[model samples]
Target: MRIVVAPDSFGGTLSAREAAEAIAAGWRRAVPGDDVRIVPLADGGTGFAEVLHTALGGTVHTREVVGPLGDPVTGSWLEVDGTAYLECAAACGLHHVGRADRVPGAARSATSYGVGQLLADARSAGVRRIVVGLGGSATTDGGAGMLAALGLVPVDEDGLELPYGGAALATCARLDGDADLGGIEIVAASDVDNPLLGPHGAAAVFGPQKGADDAAVAELDAALGVFAGVLATFAGREVRDEAAAGAAGGLGAALLALGAGVVSGAGLVRELVGLDTELDAAAAGGGPAITGEGSFDWQSLRGKLITAVARGAADRGIPCVVLAGQVSVGRREAAAAGVDSAHGVADEFGLEASMADPAGTLAELAATVAPRWGR
Candidate 1:
C-alpha cells in the first residue's frame, strides 16, 4: 500500500517538513509495508522557504535585509530549478514585531522595501522566473515601499521623496523615475483576492489583524485609495480593490501595477513541488492521502493549502485524512472543503504533553492509524 503524507507547518511547535517526517515515521512503525510519500506544504508564510526547499530539493539562500521596522533581519529564499521562491514574511513578517512593540501606530513604519531588495538580488542572479509568496507581512504601504526600493521614486508636492508607509500616500504628488526591471516575470502567491482599497480593502480588512486601531485603519485605507489613484493615472486603469490587491499589506497591488501575474498560494506550491502528481501515484498504488495544517479554522476551507491538498486528492477519487495542531470545524465543514476526516494532534494528547513531545506524539499517532490504511 501507499500513503501520501502532506501537511502544513504546525506553527511554533513544528515545521511542515518536521511534522511530516515524524508522522511518516509513526505510520511506518504501524504499517511496515506501506509506501509513504511525504509532501510538506506552505502558503507562502513564515516556513515557506524551508518547506519549498524540502519539497523541490532546492537550495535555501540566506541574506541580511531591512526588516519591517527597518532593522536588519535574516531573510531567506528558495532557488529551485533556477526559479526563485520569495517569501514576503522573511523580510516583512508581523512575527518580527516584539510583543512590547505591538502597537499599530508603531507598525505603520513597517514596509515591504526588503522584498524589493530580494527581487533585485534575484534579478541580478539572472533568474527568469520569480514567484513571491505573500503572508504574515507587517506593513500597509500598498507596496509603495517595495517600489521605492526597486528604484521607483514617490515624491510629494514640493519635490521631496516621502517616507515609506501607507500613511504618507495621501501626500504623494507624483511617481517619478522608473526602475530597470527588464524582462522579469513575477508571480504573486496569495490566497486572499481582496482589493487594495475601500471598506473591504487592505487596511480596512487586515490592518486590525496587524495591530492597527480603527483610526489607523481608516487613515491607511485613505492612503491606499490615493496611491491607487496615482497608479491609475500611470497604468491607465483603476487597480483599486483589484483581486488579490490586499495580499501582504497591499503588496499585491504593487505587483499588479508592475504587471505581475497572481495565483493561489496553495496551487503554486503544489505545482511547484509536484505534490498532486505524488498523491496521484500513491492513490494508484491503493492508499489514502493525508493532509493538514497548524490550525483548521473557518478560513481553512477558504482557499488555504490544506483544503487545496484535499481537493487534489479527492479529484483523484482518493479519501483524504487530516491531522492538525487544532481543528475548529465540524465534519460538515471539513467535508465542504473535500476533507474526509480531520483530527487535531492535541486531540490525541494533553496540550502541555503534546507541546513537549510533539514529534514523538505525532509519530505515535501516525503509527496508530497506519494499520487502517491496509498496511
Candidate 2:
C-alpha cells in the first residue's frame, strides 16, 4: 500500500515537516512494507515560507525587524526565481505575544511594521513578484503601521504621526508620504474572504483571538473604518468591502490599497506543493491519505491546509484520514468535509501525555490507526 502523509504544523509543538515525518515513521512501524510518502503543507500562516522553500528550493534570508509590540524580532523571507515568499506571521503573529502579554491593550497596539520592512527588503532585492502569506497576525491596526514603514505615515489633524496601534487610527486624519512599489506584483495569500469592515471584518472577527475585549473590538473596528476611508481616498477607489480585505488584521486591505491581488492561501499552497499530483499517484494503489493540524475543529472544515488536502485526496477517490493533536470536530462534519476518519492524540493518550510529547503521541496514534486503513 502507498500512503501519503501530509499535515500542517501542530501549533508551536511541531512543524509540518516534523509532523509528516513522525506520522510516516509510525505508519512504517505499523506496516513496514507500506510505502509512506511525506508532504507538508501550510495555508499562508506561520509555516508558509518554510514549506514553500522546501518545495521550491529557495534561498532563505533572515533579518531583525520590528515585532508586534514595537520590539525587535527575527524575521525571514524566501526568494526563488524572482519571487519573494513572505510569511506575515514571522513579523507580527500572535505567537510573538506571550500568553501573559495577550491583554486587550496589547491586542489593540500590535503592529505590522516589520511586514513592511520585509517587503522593503524584497523590493530592494529586485524581486519581480511578492507573495505575502497573511494570517496568524497579532495586529488590528488596519496595516497602518505597515504603511508607515513603507513611507506612508498616518497622521492626525495636528500633522503629528499617530502612535503605533489600531486605537490610534481613530485620530488619523490623512496619510502623509507615498508608498512606491515600483511595479512589483503583490499577492495576498489568505484563507478568509472577509471584508475589511463591519461584523465579519478584521477587528470584529479576529480581534478577540488576539485578546481584544468587546469594547476593544468595537474601537478597533471603528478605527479601521476611519483608516479604510483614508486608504480608499489614497487608492482612488474603494476596497473596504472587497473579499479578503480583512485578512491579517486588515493587512489585506492595505495590500489592496497597493493594488495587490487576493488568492486562496490553501489553493495556492496546494498547487505549489503539487498535492493533487501526489494524490493521483497515490490513487494508483489502495491506501488512505492522512492529514492533520494542531486541532481538528470547526476551522478544519473551512479552507485550511488539512481541508485542502482532504478534498484533493477525495477527488482522486482516496480515503482521507486525520491524525490531529486534538479532534473536536464531529464525525458527521468530518465526513462532510471529505474526512473518512479522524483520530486525536489527546483522546488516545490523554492531554498531559500528548502535550508533553506531541510528535510521539501523534506517531503512536498514527501507528494505532494504520492497521485499520493502511492494509
Candidate 3:
C-alpha cells in the first residue's frame, strides 16, 4: 500500500513537516509493508515559506527588519528559481507580539513595516518575481507601514509624516511614491476573500483577534476607509472592494494598488509544489492521501490547505482522509468538503491529552486508522 501524508501546521504545536513525519511513522508501524510519502503543506500563513522550502528545495534568506510594534526583528524569505516567496507573518504576525504585549493598545500601534522591508530585501536579491503570503498579520494599518517602507510615505496636511500603526491613518494626507517597483511582478497569496472595508472587512472581522476593542475596531475601520480612499486616488482605480482586498489587514488592498495579482494562497502553493503530479503518482499506486490541520471547521472547507489538498486528490479519484487535532465538522460536512474520512486526536484520547501531545496522539491515531483505509 502507498500512503501520502500531507498536513498543515497544527497551530503553535506541530509544524506541517513534523505532522507529516509523525503520520508517516504511524502509518509505517501499522502497515509495515506500505509505502509512505510525506508532503508537508501550508496556506500562506506562518509556515508558508518553510513548507515551500521543504517541498521545492529553496534557499532560505534571512534579513533584519522592523517588527509589528516598531521593534527590530529577524525575518526570512525563500529564494527559488529567481522568485522570492515571503510570508508577511514572519515579521508582522501576532505570533511575534509577546503575550505581555498582546493588548488592544498594541494593536493600535502594530505596523506592516517589516513586510515591506522583507519585500525590498527580496527585490535586492534581484528576483524578478515576489510572492507574498498574506496572513497572520498583527496590524490593521491598511498597509500604510508597508507603503512607507516601499518609499511611499503617508503624510498629513502639514506635510509631516504620520506615525506608525493603523491609528495614524486618520491624519494621512497623501501618499508620496518615492520608489518604483521597476517592472518586478508582485503576487499576493491571500487566505481570505474579505474586502478591505465594511462589516465583513478586515478591521471588523479580524480586529478583535489582533487585540482591538470595540471602539478600536470602529476607529480602525474608519481609518481604513480613509486609507482606501487615498490609495484609490493615488492609483486612479477603485481598489477597496476588490476581491480579497481586505486580507491581511488591508494589505491586500495595498498590494492591489501596487498592481499585484491576488491569488488563493493554498492553491498557489499547491501548484508551485507540484501537488497534482504528486497526487497523480500516488493515485496510480491505488493509495489514499491523508491531509489535515489543527481544526477541521467551516473555515477549513474554504480554500484552506486541507480543502485544497482534498479537492485535488478528489479530482484524481484518490480518497483524501483528514487527521486533525479536533474535528468539529460532521461526517456529512466532511464529505461535502471532499474529505473521505476525518479523525480527531481529541476524539480518541480526550482533549487534554491530545492538546498535551498532539504529534504523538496524531501518530497513534494514524496507526489505528491505517487498516481501515480501502486496501
Candidate 4:
C-alpha cells in the first residue's frame, strides 16, 4: 500500500517538513513496507519560501532591508518556476517585535522595503510572474513602503520624500510611479478579503493581534485611509474597496496600486505544489492523502488552503483527512468542504506534548485506523 503524508506547519510547534518527518517515522515503525511520500507544504503565509522551494525548486535570495521598526534586517525570498515568492514576515514579521515593543503606533513604522527589494530582484532578473505570498506582515503602512521601494515616490507637503511608515501617510500629498517593472507579473496571493479602510480593514481586524491598542488601530486605519485617497487620486480608482486590499497589512492595496490582482493564497500554493495532479495520482494509487494547517476555522471553508487541498482530494475520489493543531469548524461546514475527517491535534493533547513525542501519538492513531484499512 502507498500513502502520501502532506502536512503544513503547526505554527510555533513544528514546520511542515518536521511534521511530515515525524508522521513518516511513526508510519515506518507501524507498517515498515508501506510506500510513504513526505511533502512539506505551506499555504503561502509563514513557510512560503520553504514550500515554494520544495514545490518549484527555487533559489533563496537574501538582502538587508528595513524592518518594521526601520531597523536593518536580512530578509529573503525565492526565485523559481519563472516566478518569485515573497512574504514580508521573514524580515519584518510581528514575531520579530518584543512584547514590550508591541506598540502599534510604533510598529506602524515598519517598512515593507524588503518585499519591494524582492520584487526588484525578480524584475531585474527578467522574471515574468511573481507570486507574492501575502501573510504574517508586521508593517501596516498600507504597503506604501513597499510601493516606495518600487518607485512610487511619496512626497510630503513640501514635495520631499516622506519618511517610511503609515503615520507619514498623513503627509503624503503627491505620488509618482517610475519603478522599472519592465517585465513583472505580480500576483497578490492574499488570505483575507477585507477592504482597505473599514471595520474589516487591515488595522481594524488584524491590528490587535499584532499588538495594536484601540487608539493606535484607529490611528493606523486613518493613516491607511489617507494613503488610499492619495493613491486613488493618481490611479483614478478606489483602492480601499479592493476585495483583498486589507491583506498583508494593506500591502495588497499597495500592490493593487501597481496593477496586481488578488487570488486565493491557497490557490497559489496548490498550483505551485501540483496539488491537482498529486490528488489524481493518489487516487490511482489507492492511498489516503492528508493535508492541514495550524487552525481550521470558518475561513477554511472560504478560499483557504486546506479547502483547496480537500477539494483536490475529493476530485480524485480520495478520502482526505484534515489534521490540524486545532479545529473550530463544524461538521456540516467541513463536510461541505469535502473533508472526510477533521481531527484536531490540540483536542488530543497540547501542541508541545504532541509534537515533542509525535512518533508515539502518530503510531497510536495509525494503529487505531490500521485495521479498518487492513494496515
**TM-score sort, best first:** 2, 3, 1, 4
Report, for every candidate in turn, its global Cα lDDT versus the true structure: 0.82, 0.91, 0.88, 0.75
| Candidate 3 local lDDT, 1-375, one digit each (tens) | 677888888877898899999898888888888788888888888789998897788799998999999989899999999999999999898888887786778878899999999988888889999999988899899888998999999998888989999888988889976747778999999877888999889989889888888999999999888898889988899899998788888988999999999888999888877777778888998879999888888767766788889898889888999999999989998898888899999888999998888889999999999989835
Residue-by-residue lDDT tens digits, candidate 1, 1-375: 889998887766788889899989988888878889898888766677777776677777788988888888888887877789999988888777776766777557678888988888887887888899887788998888888888887788898998877888889877788867778788998867778887767888779877789888988888888888877776677777577888888988888888888888988888978987898897798858887777787757657788788888888888888887778889998898888888777787867777889889878777766776645
lDDT of 4 by residue, 281-374 (tens): 6677786777666688875675667777787787778887777767899888898998888777667766676677654554455444433442
Off by over 4 Å in 4: 27-34, 351-374
The model with the greatest TM-score is: 2
The better-scoring model by TM-score among 2 and 3 is: 2
Global local distance difference test of model 4? 0.75
Per-candidate TM-scores read 0.89, 0.96, 0.94, 0.88
Which whole-number lDDT from 0 to 100 does residue 373 have in model 4? Answer: 40
Estimate, for each residue in 81-131, the C-alpha lDDT of model 2 and write its tens digit. Answer: 999999999999888999888889998899999999999999999999999
| Candidate 1 TM-score, true structure as reference | 0.89
Model 1, residue 215: displacement in angstroms?
3.6
| True lDDT of residue 30, candidate 4 | 69
For model 3 the local lDDT of residue 374 reads 35
Write down the worst ten-residue block by lDDT for model 1: 99-108
lDDT of 2: 0.91
The collision pairs in model 2 are none
